[model samples]
Target: MDTCCAKALVTGKVQGVGFRRAAQEQALKAGITGHAINLADGRVEVLMCGERTAVKRLAEWLRTGPGAARVTHVEFEVIEAHAPDDFHTG
Candidate 1:
């Protein structure tokens, strides 16, 4: 199976609002592997690895996050891809 990876910088109302949890759930559902964390600059950074379609879906969700989240921007860039047996939140 082919795979792709992306490192995304998500900004705007993304912390202390279940953003990380929401991202974790979404990533798992999309069969992705990576981690999402809150940065000191009030932004969320996520590294996602998975199939192309799944990665795209995850990115789309990042743009319009959970009901409580107000994501103004989701900057995504392709990165090195790897094969992971299971998805996880780190």
Candidate 2:
């Protein structure tokens, strides 16, 4: 149960499409913590911290996003874990 963090940039039809909210919900369901925010460059930034498996699952989900999201690409980097109390949308 190694804990870890992931920073992901999700692109394509992500803004104004419930992507952040959906990401929050998914993170909660996966028992992960962090935030999802819309970037100015038409991308969504997601930071997730949790068990390695859960974080990986969340990253996989980011590739598809909510049904309305076009999700052209998802780029991610492994980071030091932050262990936030809850998931949020920004």
Candidate 3:
């Protein structure tokens, strides 16, 4: 399968709501490799690289996030693929 990368900034009520952890779980399940982290401005940033379909699926999931998260917006960019060894949370 062809690989791809997605970079997204998830906004609104995302922090302190286990958003990153949930994203990591979702990514792993989808066979994505990258990281999810809390930004200083109270948003969650995610980088996912893997199969094109898997990455796209993960990006869609980011739109809603975990049940605890009130995802108001998701800004995403498609980039050149660079696969990581594993998914991570930071």
lDDT of 1 by residue, 1-90 (tens): 778999999999999999999999999988999999999999999999998899889988899888999999989889976656797898
TM-score of structure candidate 1? 0.87
Report the CA-based lDDT of candidate 1 relative to the real structure. Answer: 0.91
lDDT per model, in order? 0.91, 0.92, 0.92
lDDT of 3 by residue, 1-90 (tens): 899888999999999998999999999999999999999999989999999989988999999999999999999998875557797899
Q: What residue pairs are clashing in model 3? A: none
- Expressed as tens digits, the lDDT of each residue in 1-90 for candidate 2 is 789988999989999999999999999999999999989999999999998999988898898988999999989999965556897899
- The residue ranges of model 2 lying beyond 4 angstroms of the native Cα positions read 82-90
